[model samples]
Target: MENSHASPGLLKQANSSALHRALREKGAATRAQLAAATGVSVTTVRALLEEMLRDGEVERTGLGASSGGRRAAQYSLRRDKYYGAAVCITDGQAHGLLVDVHGEIVRAVPLKAGADGLRTPVLAFLDGLFAQRDIRSIGLGLPGVVREGCFWHADKEGGLHSVAVEPALSRRYGVPVVLENDVNAAAIGFARCYETEFPGEDPAETNMAYLHFDRGCVSAGFVAGGRVIRGCGHFAGELGLVPTADGRLLDECLNDPQDGREYTARVLEAAVWVCGILNPRYIALGGPALRRECIGPVNDGLSALLPGPMCPELLYTADIWGDYQIGMAWLTAEKIFHMVQIIKK
Candidate 1:
């Protein structure tokens, strides 16, 4: 199926991408180390490193420890070569961070939103960052249903209802813009952190559901096969809309629990739905209402409803804001790298 004429170019691009990714993971490495990691010949690795250095995409850090003879030159992705701006709109505030190609935060810009909506604060924050750094792409995380990079639906209290955030941002910044649901972003962030903590496990085995209960409402985000499982129409994690047994919405029962027992029952119902369908490896429970005492009962209730193998480990995730920002940074960096690969093509 391979075309002999085009194979060489495609192979070169693939090898180049592998080298860059290895550097991103290793921070800096010599030609021989890169070749060994990427399974590319030493001569080909040297040529690609020279090309990247000439293009200013990579830089020489210094000489590495000599293995047998002379010290090999070390190479790394240029820290200032590309930047991605990740912004999260929540609680009448816009939090933004300037992330580099290595997924490190270059700068953080947090601002209070105005009455006009998140648009004002988001624009002002981005304008300030763009004035100083050349941002390659933008990632926006919103608490709502996002369909094809558009904010389709949110509670009327949220000012960003029915707004097309992605294209509007792309037009203003003249770069790729990604819009993702807040919970979904948090799920990806949780998965990444989990993998980092337990590096021995295969990342592809990361399947999880992150549930957030706040202000009398609950929603969920799912990650399967190391990717966010945004189903058709992008309404996959809208758990609050799911109905309950007594002919009322799930949020209705959650909004008005009589006692701690009833509250635990309501949460158990939600977990049952998540386990019965997704059967993820973990169900990360978080938000304001999630208490340490309630997790035990929720887990016990889930086990009673499903078989041992079907039940997922329930984890309490604090610091939703932190997870959201990390997720946005990861996504923005991925977009920038994808753009670089497209340019090569």
Candidate 2:
């Protein structure tokens, strides 16, 4: 039988890309190991590595252990060659961070969103950033709906909605800007966590969801087949609008004393609806709700609300203090650097 982890010529360009991706994750890898991992010919792998090294993308790692032969020079990726700036805005507060390729925050600044200074502060901030440190691109996540680089939202009707925000920020920053719903950005971070953990696996093999309950509003993102589908206008996973018996959402139903009961019921009903449509493998919940000590109430609520076939166990990781702050920064950086612009290539 043919070796599954093997390939023919496999196009010079494809081999180069595969080698770069592997280098990004493994830090250092030998030519033989790279060939085994990438299913490309050893000659092709060496050529790709040489190309990247010449382009300042990869570098030699001094030297490594010798095995009955001349000590071969080890090699690794040169991640320091690039860095990104990420900004996340929620309610009326905007925070910025400098993120490296490894997703570490090198610098961070918080700016209060204002009626007049929102644009100027950010513009000055970006200009000053060039003076302080190096940044290759910019990534931003907005609290509300985004269109043409601006924030806007509405109910079923167009009367109650937010205005747009992308153009102003894009102009201020100059670097390539990508605007995504804050909730969706959080979800992107969560999905990225899974991706990093299971590098070699096809992430599309499993489904994961993240529910973030922020101060004013609650939102969620659903991941299926390894990608976050942000529907038209970059708004896809809005858990707040899940239907209800009296035409109200779970969030909106929290009016009277007994609203939690109805809200729980509606959420459960919605879960079944989701299960019917997607049949997810795992459903993980994050955000503020998980802060509650005993999320048994949430699990019980979801269990009671969903049907047998649709009821997936609820798992919570309320460790958002670190995850949220870093996730926001990483999402912003990843969105700017590793997102469509880089990935599609």
Candidate 3:
């Protein structure tokens, strides 16, 4: 929980995260802008930024654009000095990535996961990927529901609980890890990308839903106020369990591939279902089944379903389709950094 009166240490960590987020937005920020963006006082921002500067967390850039008065000093993170490792472990494939502080993909490598539909190989494979990277922090995106900082999945033992996947894996590498739902990670990426596309102060535009459709489907994350909507136990976007007569959920779609017509019908049905309930601005589609060719008919049908209300534009790029593993790796890196910050205190 975040408190207005946080402990000194928590306050510093929170401010650091705030500073990082602000810097990421335009790759540079002035003290006043950072203060206004984070709701932190200018004095506090200077103190915290100075502390970060001393620790090599932020670097001073040239002067900002001239306002009415003297130009303020600008600052940006030293992306090269810091690296983040991420693992996006979907139901089908696993991907690892090394990202700079800017959240841009630097190194993207794919990994084969669960060839026999088992957990041991996937687990071992993930460990090896991290070993090769020798990263300081890790972020992991899983295919299942994550609750109370814990995630539940299928293992040798059926229905195994795994929240501290990073910690468990960290036991081997001795680093911090943050295991998150893949949908949540995708949502984060979508939110960031969208925010980059459309700059804003109001939170409504940032508040939207992202759905990743594959064999067994998943909705990664939802954002309001430019922050992930993490429900208690972090199960905010687990739309899989939404009650339905046909049992059509994210995971169910991913695991069961059908004929093109059947797949199109089922997905259109899903679009109608989501439209009735969510009515989001735009729907982001990912996973294996959401290819450019695959979504056209469904798009036409869904467009026909609604006239005045703009049918949410669909986004199905290769990055969302084939590069999920890399996205996962980026996610893991984010988690690891967060965990390190928490534990170092």
Candidate 4:
């Protein structure tokens, strides 16, 4: 009898998980829409939605356009019910933002110097933000590599090398913490921004790459089939390490921009190599050195390097910083949702 009951319970949990994920990906949906999206019966979807409504996890947000007789009710995750904290650590400063479940920033604190210095201010900011609300998870975007939520290295001295960042923060805050490379976070954020900006275009089904050129050095982050490719050791996109024909590193040539044509040539050379390798749907140019003036030359160089049919669209991401923070927030929200699923199981 207990085993018989357990089978149904497990089925219900699976259906619930499917429904929750559908709602999350779609942002908001009607009961019928959720049913179709999840491939679950309307009856089951309604039951799960009711449970979510009662738990304050879901809320009705007006009505959808009438498909036939009457307008259907729309449901959305309760944006204010939960929040996440996002921190981006750079060479000298850490930037933090408080984001709601809907991936909107509620508050942003001033930048602080050093990881240790960032701890006090960021924690205090989160403490104040969580004073009246619940923060589900925290995500940190470091300037260097991360593995299994552990800090590896950063560009600057006195970085995350010696600290057990994720565990320490998770223990301190009593919530899950995710650590990722800053460029990777920016790539995730860029994907989110693309989805938001172009609702009709699905980034999940596409291949995209974000190339970050910072202080003459370059690194790349790739997204294939909606997932970030971190590679075996989480060092997938270390493009800067690739040397040039002259036996000099890519960064060496990029740093010495005395000759405009030479600078353009080097940039184009790297871009061409990336295109040949990934053949991505699009490549976004980011980081400090990708200025407005450089775009024209880069485009010209690209035009000369590859034929029109083989060339991928090149775009300059102007909001890498903002996107990095938002990506961290989205990652934190995903962690929270996964935790909820685990608890239910």
Best by lDDT: 1
lDDT, model 2, position 120: 63
Model 2 bad stretches (over 4 Å): 1-18, 35-41, 62-74, 114-117, 147-150, 154-174, 194-202, 259-263, 286-294, 301-310, 319-345
TM-score of model 4 vs. true structure = 0.88
lDDT of 3 by residue, 20-113 (tens): 7667656898999999988778999999889889988789999999978999999888776666676666666666667677667777666664
Question: What's the distance in Å from true for residue 260, model 3?
Answer: 5.8
Lowest-sum lDDT 10-residue window in model 1 = 336-345
Q: Give Cα-based local distance difference scores for all models.
A: 0.82, 0.63, 0.65, 0.79
Candidate 1 residue spans exceeding 4 A from truth? 1-15, 29-41, 61-74, 154-161, 339-345
Sort by lDDT, best first: what order? Answer: 1, 4, 3, 2
The regions of model 3 sitting more than 4 angstroms off are: 1-17, 112-136, 155-164, 170-175, 199-204, 207-209, 216-263, 290-294, 321-345
* Per-prediction TM-score to the true structure, in the order listed: 0.86, 0.74, 0.72, 0.88
Ranking by TM-score: 4, 1, 2, 3
lDDT of 1 by residue, 203-287 (tens): 6678899999878778889987877888887879888889887778888888884588877887888889888888899999998
Q: Considering every candidate listed, which one attains the maximal TM-score? A: 4
Clashing pairs in 1: none
